[model samples]
Target: MVAKYVMLADTTRCINCKACEVACRAEWDTPLGYSRDWVKEVESVNAKGMPELQIFPGRCQHCDDAPCVEVCPTGASWKREDGIVLVDHDICSGCELCVPACPYDARWLNPVTNTISKCTFCQPRIDKGLQPACVETCVGNALIFGDANDPNSEVSILLKTKEWQRLITDEVNIGPNHYYYTAGKTIPVEVMPKLHERHLAGKSIESIVNPLGTIGIGGMMAVFLGAGVKKLVDRRKEVSEKEDNHEHH
Candidate 1:
């Protein structure tokens, strides 16, 4: 049977030490301004009118029907048989089309590679029979990663024994694989996925390039295609020169 991987974050157990964040950065060489995973602290008043704080460790939800995959013109985004969503960096045009498509705000354009980047469930480590960096380094053991298809897997067992809720909204239901164990408590509004707004660049693409593509306007499409190609070339050259300079230092 094909393995179906899933991740569980027990909100009751997280300590907000940021160990997972640190480990992910070290593992992926993520740029200083960005991260693959994060811990969100939600402060709310409970039913008893007492202050309560819920800590949620979050990342790409790795949805079953990922909108990012559906909207990519270059097919750079894809999902593996094991359910890990990833970007094919070599093919990515850095068009940033998939960024707003994700409701969870998971995808980002990497400054170094000029490609879309997101959490991959630590595929390289998993391929070598190791846990994800974040899961392995979690200080409170709140993060769990394993094959949900395997009944004996820890995640599967947890799902069977524990009450969990996924972060979902009425407007966006993508069947996210990330689960949160909240012990039957109502999930806080702060922890839910918010509606994304298209940036100026995204709006421009939608209004101009998308319409041209749809109507098969060959000349205009070619012009837009050339611009995309030029951007990719410029980025690659920039990265190459930086690498050469680093080697000489």
Candidate 2:
């Protein structure tokens, strides 16, 4: 059977050690300031007025209907058949259009690559029949990764036997694949999914390019379209110059 990959976070067992964060950074050689994964600590008061803490390990949800894929003009963002969302760095223009499209804010522009970057579910490691770096390094065994479509897969079994919830909001419904076990309690409002405002280019596309195509009236939309064209041209020139410089050296 074709495999559908998924990740599970058992918040009940998490220790908030940030091991996953460290492992991901090391695996990807992520820049000093950026990370592909993070563990968020949510603090609140319980019914007894006692301190309550919830730790959520987060990364790209690899949504079935990914908005990142939709907003990418260069088609650099794509979803693999196995449910991994990835950036094709070779084609990415570093436009940062996909960054704001994600409700989870899981993506970022890598300083080194100058391209959109996000969690890939450790595709390279999985291809070698190994677990993701984060999963392998998890101290408390709180993270689980496997094929969700296989009835015998650990993730599939867990979903069937345990209660879980995906981060979601009324404004956006992208069908995220990441599942969190919150122990039957409602997730905190701060950590719940929220749609971020679209980038200017994305807004232009939605309001002007898509709606009017080549017939956009004299307005900020036209200005945005012109600026977009200029940016694309500049990018091509930059790449060409870089290649020429490399040849000269």
The most accurate candidate by lDDT is: 2
TM-scores for the candidates: 0.80, 0.84
lDDT for model 1: 0.90
lDDT of 1 by residue, 1-249 (tens): 998889999988999999999999999999999999998898888889999888999999999998888777788999999899999998999988889888888999999999998999999999999999999999889999999999999999999999889999897788899999988888888778877556576666778879877788777788999999999999999999999999999
lDDT of 1 at 40: 89
Model 2, range 95-185, lDDT digits (tens) per residue?
A: 9988888889899998898998899999999989899999999999999999999999899999999999999888877899999998998
Q: How far is candidate 1 from the true structure (C-alpha RMSD, Å)?
A: 17.7
lDDT of 2 at 150: 93
In terms of lDDT, the poorest run of 10 residues in model 2 is 211-220
Report how far off residue 248 is in candidate 2 (Å).
83
Residue 98, model 1: lDDT of 88
Stretches of candidate 1 exceeding 4 Å from the true structure? 196-249
- Per TM-score, the best of the predicted structures is 2
For model 2 the TM-score comes to 0.84
